[model samples]
Target: MSESLLAALLALLVVPALLAIHAGDLLLATLTLGGYGFAMALTWAALGAVDVAFTEAVVGAGATTVLMLAALLRTTRRRSPLPGRLRWAALLVVGTVGLALGAVTAALPPWGDPDTPAAVHVSPRYLTSAVAETATPNVVTAVLADYRSYDTLIETVVIVTAGLGCWLLLGPRSR
Candidate 1:
């Protein structure tokens, strides 16, 4: 079979399996959520983002979902009724906004296209001058870890702060 045909068949099989995975049981629901995270990691890997895939696999499939399930285990097991009119209206508005944002994204430049202005402008200089300036073979690594180090450092600090906040909030509160 052709590669495209195999991929299409795999997607056809996977879509319904994913959609059918709703579970009233919290443990089963958590497993389903982790499965979804693993799927997302697979998608990131397919897109050539190994770093993102690794992070997603670790955080999403491993830590976050486990934490969620643990919290759920500590709470009540019964399912609650769906929210009322105000919440439905808010959800509708949010969905509409999300659809509009997705439409805008669909019109954006295709990734990694050399003809796109973004690819042309930022890429050429990095490719041409990175080795000379940094003595690094990987231009992307050099740019991310060196030239834009401040931005990366700030993002790391933000993540650490968020983790600390979560730990503090979830920790025991003494009277």
Candidate 2:
């Protein structure tokens, strides 16, 4: 995808995210949050991160959204409005953090640069020995499921635990 198109799509992602954060209705916020995740997944795929996009779609948008809705079913409170001063303070803090992060990112090596750490070290090893080391024909599968198994397993455990916790919190109480 063209950079301009990716930028446009990412810009759309931010609008839904802002609305989700500010939504007065918890249900609406949850749904909007799912949309935001889906947009992020799309952005990831466009940036040539298919594995990340798949994980985002499955866990971020799908499982997390379902878990949030299930958790919402156990809740009495809907909207908790923040005070004006606090909201402004939050906005200021978020803006400052975002700007700082952006500056740090801008200072990083350009994407796909041969001298970058991953390019210099990780890629060469993976490309040369992935199949021999992992016995996996596909390099990505080898890296994700074999070489990075612990990381992937931890991520799965966290998502499953969160979903299960929400499921357990479902009310059986009689009013």
Candidate 3:
């Protein structure tokens, strides 16, 4: 993707994020956040991470939005306002974290650079020997299911736990 297109996508991502943050209505915030997720998916796609983009679109923009809207159905539309001091404190913390992250990002190699540590260290082994090592034809599948089995299992467990928690919290309550 061209630099201008990527920059535009990044800019688009920020608008919905800011809108979601500043939105008083929970519904509006939820919708804005969905837009932010979609924009994030587009950004990921532009960066040549199509799998990540699909996951973001499905889980971030789709499932998350549906879940939030369902939760909203059981709650008030408007959120309780935060006190001035607390809001400022939250903003300060967010700004500090954002700046720190920006600094770290600026220090990193360019996206998809072939000489990055990850690409140089482990990726070549995975790309060349994944099929023989794991008996999986697809490198991504082999990596996720075989090489990174524990990580993938933990991520699955976390997702399942989150789903259960959401269900228990949002499901019909008995008297």
lDDT of 3 at 149: 96
Candidate 2 Cα outliers beyond 4 Å, as residue runs: 112-114, 150-175
Q: For each candidate, C-alpha RMSD in Å?
A: 4.2, 3.2, 2.7
Model 3 poorest 10 in a row by lDDT: 166-175
* Better lDDT candidate (1, 3): 3
Which 10-residue window of candidate 1 scores lowest in summed lDDT? 13-22
**Most TM-score-accurate candidate:** 3
**TM per candidate:** 0.70, 0.80, 0.81
- Candidate 3, residues 1-175, lDDT tens digits: the string is 7999988888778789999988999999999999999989989999888878999999889999998898799877788887899989988999999999999999899976989998899789999999788988878788888999999989989989987887786568622
Q: Report lDDT (CA) for all predictions.
A: 0.76, 0.87, 0.89
Error of 3 at 12 (Å): 1.5
Candidate that beats the other on lDDT, 1 or 2, i.e. the better one:
2
Alpha-carbon RMSD, candidate 2? 3.2
Off by over 4 Å in 3: 134-137, 163-175
